[model samples]
Target: MIDVYLLSGFLGSGKTSLLSHIIEQFKKEGTKPAVIMNELGKLPFDSRAVEADVPLKEMLEGCICCTGSEKMEAQLQMLLEGESFDVLLIETTGAAHPVEAMDAVYSPLFASKLNMKGIITVADCKRWLDRDKMTPQTRMLFLEQIRHAHLIVANKIDLLTDSEIATVTMQLQALNAKAPIIQTSNSKLPLNIMKKIEATFHEKEINETAIGKQLFLSSRLHTFQEPVNQEDFECWLKELPDTVYRMKGYVPLVGHKNPLLFQYAYGMVQWLPEMIKMPPQIVIIGDQVDRIDVLGRISND
Candidate 1:
């Protein structure tokens, strides 16, 4: 399976810069890379960073997550049918939500053909520190982008004062307790970022087995055999830990004839009405979650 990496960050947070660096590194290691870049404008700019030799597919006019899932799936199919590459990189628009972008990539049609490496979020240190100046929606988006990352690149540290750096680092750590953060300037990264990330994951795997902790970025699927009380489910959601980054599936709520499509990210929960019958299961993604305990609580409810 081809390894897939999703690049996420707010506008001017150095996502394109990081994408360029990653592609260059892959080229040095004799690995061919393909890119699927999303832009929220009519014209594409980040597409220039992708080299001519690298197979490229651009999604312009909207964020991939906001765009129809069918479009995203079709683009992936086209790339797979036409290109040969060791790795695929998706650069999302600044306005995109990391969890939603991931949902788009998890299309069942191409799921078996790819191995999800993880989301690598590039955050501008100064921008992160001043995120409150942004509109409420934008600020929430910024936080969510950082919160759901598998690996974070705290970029543009050159512009931040020493004290500001500490403040931002502390906040980033608080938001994402497990993802490794690499401080950089100009979106520059260490030559072994991938190796370091892999090593970190391996260590987490060992720790998981030794201490009975959930694996970092691990996912669990739970299928409900019967409909659950809506009030009970909402209460359970409120009690979920912040480590539960994302969850999505169909849920059969009491009093409803059909299961509702549910999506949760960060602290927000969305339940969309579904007309057709769907599987009653949820895919929970998080770090160090107590799977047995979590399932038990929901099952008892």
Candidate 2:
């Protein structure tokens, strides 16, 4: 079992700095930690912040709540199959909601492989009290991140006075009564607080329909002697319902005999020719279709 920690904060709230420190600390101790950096757009700037030598997977082009869970699930599954790692760190998009991202991890596939290592919310103390200055959407996103956290880093304390820190910490407590607040300058959170902490989350039951509406993955258990058509595959993808957010797997059409490697993020798709005689195994998860109803059909066909 791996300890998966979700590191969440508003944009530019020093999430990268804190996570970088965590990564570097582990590296010094001769340990490797896997990170899943969730980005809001196609530009994967956040993933570039860490050392490429360490394994860091980037999930870009969709929000964890609505458009990216299927890809996220597939990526996590692939990682679980690899060399054992000490921990999993997920850095959510600043515009994303933490609860929805956490809820998405509770799927049957990841049920036992991962355990919650607590959610950490990093707050910019200087901007913490300026609720009126933020846009409605930004404000909602910030509060939601704080509300679901088990540990909060009231960060950037150097920019604030004692009174300011006290006020902001109180506000955070009011929003998240359960989370322990830590005052920090540059996200100097104590590592001990995060280690072995049991998370307490009173979340709403996630309906599978919501899952279907987001993940578009569907796979079959058939041996295709013939390859699939590139143009026809593209056409089928284009005609799929808008809910199908990401759709690319080891499926081959009629022309190319090899596995037609594909990857779709948001609406952008890429096809790469491959050498591995991969089984025609495909997995699509997003708000695309009823997962069991849709995925099970693939095995039947």
Candidate 3:
């Protein structure tokens, strides 16, 4: 049976960074790691972070929970049939509810071929400190992500002051007393820390109170026709409502030949230069987003 680990975390909480670390560790140990990356839009951005040689499958256009269970079963079957790997990692979308994601993976058709290693959740330390700013639904989503993990990674601690880090640690411990919490910058997990997660005999634990499909979130995709002035684009970002949780993709900026990878989460934004040309498009995800209005604004300028 292939070992299966479900990587769960809130939007922009360093799930992808942890994924890279896990892949590297498995490679060093001579174990092949296969990945199933889920995205809420037609164009996938995070999957690009995975190496080219690893076996990977992308589930786009919906959350694993929102997408039909049969769809997940089919993807698992395809991977099982086509790949030769020791471990499989399923990276759920940021908007996904943990209970719903867990339910999707426990399909009876493929359950026996897989060993359900516990959930590994990455929590953003600064996000937890400022979670009060999030919508009620989003706050609950963040809580649920931590509640169900077997291993909790408190990421981005470097940004927090000593007092803030202490507060965040206490809060996470209160929320999840059962899981081991590790603090790290950039979601770096030591090889031994993974062993602590692996040593956990994870049985399928589904919290009945989990807010499954009730969390209403939506995503919109917009492609840019012309390079955008950085100053003007950032000014528009201020106009977006706080309900807009995540926005990530490649953007063609003035004076740059290649598109820069842009990510925005909870009032924070980042841009990374890209060496090769990429499609200039962005996917915006949020709770009850004004898609019509937001899309119109994005399409213009």
Candidate with maximal lDDT: 3
Error of 2 at 139 (Å): 1.3
Which residue ranges in model 3 land beyond 4 Å of their true spot?
A: 198-213, 291-301
Supply the global lDDT for candidate 1: 0.74
TM-scores, in order shown? Answer: 0.65, 0.66, 0.91
Q: Tens-digit lDDT track for model 1 on 1-301? A: 9888888986667788798998899899899999999865444545767889999988866667655467778889999999898999999876677767867888778878988888888988877776666545456677878887888999989988899999999999998898889999878876477544431233221111101121133446678889887777878888886556556678998878899987665445778888888778776655445453554555433
Range of the 10 consecutive residues with the lowest summed lDDT in candidate 2? 292-301
Tell me which residue pairs clash in candidate 1: none
* Ranking of models by TM-score: 3, 2, 1
Residue 279, model 3, lDDT: 96
Cα-based lDDT for every prediction = 0.74, 0.67, 0.83
Model 1 TM: 0.65
- Each candidate structure's count of clashing pairs: 0, 19, 0
Candidate 1 lDDT at 224 equals: 86
Report how far off residue 193 is in candidate 2 (Å).
Answer: 1.7
